[model samples]
Target chain A: MDPINFVILAAILFAIGSAAVLLRRNAIIAFMGVELMLNAANLSLVSFSRIHGEIDGQVMAFFVMVVAAAEVVVGLAIIIAVFRARQTISLDEPSELKG
Target chain B: MVNPLLFWIIAALTVIPSLSLLFARKAVHVAMAIVLVMVGLAAAYVALGAPFLGVVQIVVYTGAVMMLFLFVLMLVGVDQREDLKETIKGQRWIGLLAAGGLGAFLVSVVARVALPVQEETVGEPDVIAEVLFQRYVLVIEVLGFLLITAAVGALVLTHAPRLKPRRTQLEVQRDRVRVGANPVNKPMPGVYARHNALDVPALDPEGQPIEDSVSRVLKIRHQTQDGAEFRAQLEDPARKDTEEGR
Candidate 1:
């Protein structure tokens, strides 16, 4: 199979992830959509690295993974904080100005 | 180049499970599906000559990231259902259409422009490390700082401050007495000799069963036995005589 197919798969996953972010009302699920998008980008990066015959793409993917990890930590902490204050993780409910 | 069959398998693994993110009602099920997608991506990385990246993907995404998601999920609520009502009329369709268009555009653009495939080196740990340390060492140092900051940030966000002093047992007792509550402990369940069980209520001085002796949860569930019946049988002198003869 052409390695470009990997890119196509990544695009498809990215689309699904976006759909999730838009459609899902739950904060955790939406956060997971973000994770999915990151993973899709990583897949595409690795595929590009393979196509170009260099380790640079893989290294970039590594960096992306680190950032994604950090993002997950802070994001989940915020989710917990919001849930504690509002007692609901629905993204819509927290849209009101007052805490 | 990935094997056609292998790519198809990976595609199936990723694409099918990822749909759950949009459709699955339970956040837990969606989380699990995303995990599967991560694994599939890891496999694709390995297949495309980046084994090192593949391993990191599995360790980081499946092990750490998804586990954190699950922990938060449980902390929030395992059975927490989403408000599926779309407040913005037709918002779901609009979102799906936009995403689908984006995907179609990307695939067409990529497929049309034939990027030459050349697999020079398998991304083993040592090979990846050489590149990582030499060119990206500074990035790595920054990442370490980021991780530490994230850990501290998480602690700060979730940490609940002590708003009030903890009420001690003595203070609690004093408050109960002031409120005119029964300061003494309730009698233990199972007052009778033959029927010593938690569901059996102890009798008060007035010969009435003390309902509070049994657990409130047990009473609510109708799991408690009536101590009144046992007390009545015991009080019957004729029944006691028959019991003694037997």
Candidate 2:
């Protein structure tokens, strides 16, 4: 794959997904958007590795996947418990935790 | 140069779902859109010659994690109706302003910036694995610990005895009322009352109905504090007299 094409596409996806995380109220949706952003970063990493003729970026991608998986399982479980307690999963509802 | 047609097609697939996540009114649709986007990203990863990561992305993310998200969404019944009012004041405007600012920054950077062109050498998964296991052995071990911790933690977190809420007064009252229905007074109609007027439920709270009775009957007895007792039974005579009087 041409690195530039991949870079451009990854940048666009990153931008949109970040915008979504910023704009959305629902925590799960925002988290999904954050995943999209992370995927975009993975795309960039892999693309760069391909360009430089190295496997390091690919390795980092593996680490990112691990972290993302961890975050999703624990993050979502906590979100579920919070929603049960508070009766709302919207980020706005959980403002008390901001401190 | 990359194949323009393939590039456009993959770009379309990836962008469509990401945008869908933005505009989908229902949380389920949004979750589904995220899954689609992950699938598209995996395909793009494969196209970029990271076949192993591509498969991992699909299997671990799109298959397992996103499905968990969808399951929770369904379990919590997060549909269109459950969308809470955005609680943050001026959030929309702030978001728009920030997004617009970022967009403008990106556009300006793209206008002036140019990425250096470079040649790519695609390697096989085995070669990648050699480099990963040999050079990055410790990293892999740490990742294994991370995965184990995550798995154990997830199981623990999800399975932990949630504070078993004491039944609410209303719920307890409702259950008591249902259970207090005496079995001898009259046979309550089956779940499908219209289907079997005489066919009382096996689990009915009251006694069985008389055969060939066209009208369903209910007998209720109330005991007075003074020890007087009276009974009310719906019989053909009582029903006929009531109907006639009405």
Candidate 3:
């Protein structure tokens, strides 16, 4: 399989994820979009690792996974708190800080 | 030669559900879709010869992180639908255009740039660990600290102080008297009542236990008979027959 194919796939997935983040109103779904983008990047990293005949890309992928996990934890906590306070998880609902 | 067929199949699996994840209306469905995508990505990782990352992707993202997402979805309840009204006018169209432009640019760049392709090397877990713990030790430690900070920050954000502060027995009694309601007798209103002090069974004002919608639809009701009598009748068919005959 051509390594460029994987890169193309990753690019397409990242684009879909970006579209989701842009278009979705639900904060959780937007968060899922962010995760999808991260996964796409991880795929590219693994592909590059294979292309380089080294383990560095895989190690970087592992670090990305760890960071993604931590990010989800904090992000979900903030989303839940916002939901608790305002009774909505819609990103546009929290306009108090908009000004 | 690497199997292109497997690569195409896994790539399709990874991409399809990730796109669907965006369209899922309910948060729970979105979470499940993301899990499917993560599993597909893990398969892709394995196909790329990073077995360790593939397994870790499944264990961490699909297993733990997705579970956390599901937990939050359930905790917050999935019944609340998001308001679809756009806060910023024409944002959706602009976003779509931007994303499309970005995708085209990336694909073109990837096609044009010829990276030197080396022979595929299967990542050995031992070498990864050695490099991670030796050369990238500081980075690993920093990630550990970030995780801890995330945990603490999550707790701080979501923690709600108890509505009723801790009070002595006398203070509780005085508050009950002052409020002109017996704290021990009256049921607390609202979904988040701290405790059911009266040990009252969950029942409506009609003195009947609230039946679930499914049970109501099925026309099922609780038996009025005692537990011991119900057990005896189940144990002896003859006795039940005699009672019916009588």
Candidate 4:
């Protein structure tokens, strides 16, 4: 299989994830979209690692995974706390910061 | 020869579930879709000859992170559905247009670039570990600190504060008489105070149930089970439990 196929697939997945992040009203779903985008980048990294015959990309993928895991914990905590304070998870409802 | 068909199938699996995740209405369904997508990505990693990455993807992303997401979702109650109404005017159109534009640009660049066809490297765990601990050891240590920060930050963000001021036992008795509910000193018969009776949720001074998401869900459930009479008793605190007389 051509490595470009995997790159194209990553591109498509990234697009879908970006769209979800921008369009979804739910904070948790938008957070999931961010995760999807991160995974797409990881896929591209692995494919490039395969094409170049190097282990650097794979190592980078590992670091990305660690950061992503940490991000999910902090992001979900903030989301849950907001839900508790306001009783809703809709992004539209938290316009109190609007100046 | 590696099967091109397998790559195509795995690619389809990866893309389809991610799309479904965007469209899923409930948070639980979204979590499940993310799990499927993570598994598909792991298969794609194995197909790309990164067995170590595939295994890590499954263990970390699918196993630990997704489990955390689902646990938080259940704790926060899945009954809360997002409002589908567009919050920002034309936000959906703008998002679609931008995503489409970006995808087109990336696809064009990818199609035009020439990737050298080299022998695929098998990323064995030993080689990855050696490089990780040797060259990237500092990064790994920093990541450990990051994880610690994340844990502490999550705890701080989700910490629930005490709802009311602590009162002395004598003060509690006076307040209980003022509110005219159950006496503070007497425990209900047959119910161990610590086991069941002592933890009876305190109502607001107005005798209304606390307005929180979980209690709101439990209230709805109670209403559905007992129908109109139960709902009336809930709304009116004046009604005594006639069943307790038996």
Task: Give the proportion of true interface contacts each model preserves, from 0 to 1.
Answer: 0.89, 0.47, 0.78, 0.76
DockQ of each: 0.84, 0.53, 0.72, 0.64
Q: How well is each residue in A1-99 modelled by candidate 3, as lDDT tens digits?
A: 677678788998899999999999888889888998998899899988888888899999999999999999999999999999988888888788966
lDDT (Cα, tens digit) per residue for candidate 1, span A1-99: 788888888999998888888888899999999999998999899888988999899999999999999999999999999999989999889767666
Q: Give one digit per residue, the lDDT tens place, for model 1 in B1-246.
A: 668999999999999999999888888898899899889888898998988888888999999999899999989988877777888999989988998998899888888878877756799999999988998899999999999999999999999999999999999889989989997887788656878789988777887877788999998999999866876898999999999999
Over B70-106, each residue of candidate 2 has an lDDT whose tens digit, in order, gives 8888877775253445566777678767765775676
Give the clash count for each candidate. Answer: 0, 0, 0, 0
Where model 1 places Cα greater than 4 Å from the true spot, the runs are: A97-99, B191-194, B227-246
Q: Show pairs that collide, candidate 2.
A: none
Tell me the lDDT of model 2 at A48: 79
The runs of at least 3 residues in candidate 4 whose Cα sits more than 4 Å from the true structure, single-residue gaps closed, are B163-246
lDDT of 4 by residue, B149-179 (tens): 9999999999999999978899977887888
Which regions of candidate 3 deviate over 4 angstroms? B166-246
In model 4, what is the error at residue B131, expressed in angstroms?
0.7
Give the C-alpha interface root-mean-square deviation per candidate.
0.9, 2.4, 1.3, 1.3
Output the worst ten-in-a-row residue range by lDDT, candidate 3 chain B.
B190-199
Runs in model 2 deviating more than 4 A are B80-86, B107-119, B160-179, B183-246
- Model 4 lDDT at residue A93: 94
Model 4, position A43: C-alpha lDDT score: 92
lDDT at position B240, candidate 3: 69
Task: Give candidate 4's whole-model lDDT.
Answer: 0.82
